[model samples]
Target: MKIISEKCKKCLVCIDACPVKAISKKGEEVTINGDICLECGCCASSCPNNAIEYE
Candidate 1:
């Protein structure tokens, strides 16, 4: 899953929605740590702005 910065509103919902705790905020950018990500699309679903893309 990748976060689209243009679409992201910094809601921080994806951070809490991640089951593996892979999502984090850094310097105003909400990012998903690929190392801990499960690719379950949890963060993608939680994003109201459609900023998270899971491929």
Candidate 2:
């Protein structure tokens, strides 16, 4: 999964939706921890800004 930074609104919605707690935030930036991520698309689905992508 990846975050499309240009589209991200920093809402933290993806962080709350991650089932494995793979998402993290630093300041206004959000990132997914690839090693811990399940790639379940939970965060992607929850993001209102469509910032998270699964590939």
Candidate 3:
């Protein structure tokens, strides 16, 4: 999965939706830890801004 930073609103919606807790936030920056990500597309689906994309 990938995060389109331009499209991200930093809402952290995807973080709540991530089952693996792979998403994290620092200040206004949100990121997905690839090593912990399950790639289940849960984050992608939950992104209201369509910031997360899955392969």
Candidate 4:
């Protein structure tokens, strides 16, 4: 799944939840490349800050 940056707090919740380690930090933003995302909702649901969401 892809994430909406506006809703993201850069909390890193999605970063830790990704089993494939696809999440990454870019400056103050948490970014996930769709190519490596695997379409798993794990990161989205794990985000306590609601930083990640489905595309």
What tens digits encode model 1's per-residue C-alpha lDDT throughout 1-55? 8999999999999999998899889998998899989999988888999999975
Residue-wise lDDT of candidate 2 within 1-55, one digit each (tens)?
Answer: 9999999999899989988899999777898999999989999899999888877
Best by TM-score: 1
Candidate 2 CA-lDDT value: 0.92
Task: Give candidate 3 regions above 4 Å deviation.
Answer: none
Instruction: Score candidate 3 by lDDT.
Output: 0.88
* lDDT for predicted candidate 4 compared with the true structure: 0.80
Per-candidate total of colliding backbone pairs: 0, 0, 0, 0
5: Cα error in model 1, Å:
0.4
- After superposition on all C-alphas, the RMSD of every candidate to the true structure, in Å, is 0.8, 0.8, 1.1, 1.3
Q: What is the lDDT of residue 52 in candidate 4?
A: 67
The total number of steric clashes, by the backbone 3 Å criterion, in model 4 comes to 0
Q: Which structure is stronger by TM-score: 3 or 4?
A: 3
Task: State TM-scores per candidate.
Answer: 0.94, 0.92, 0.89, 0.80
Candidate 4 has a TM-score of 0.80
Clashing pairs in 2: none
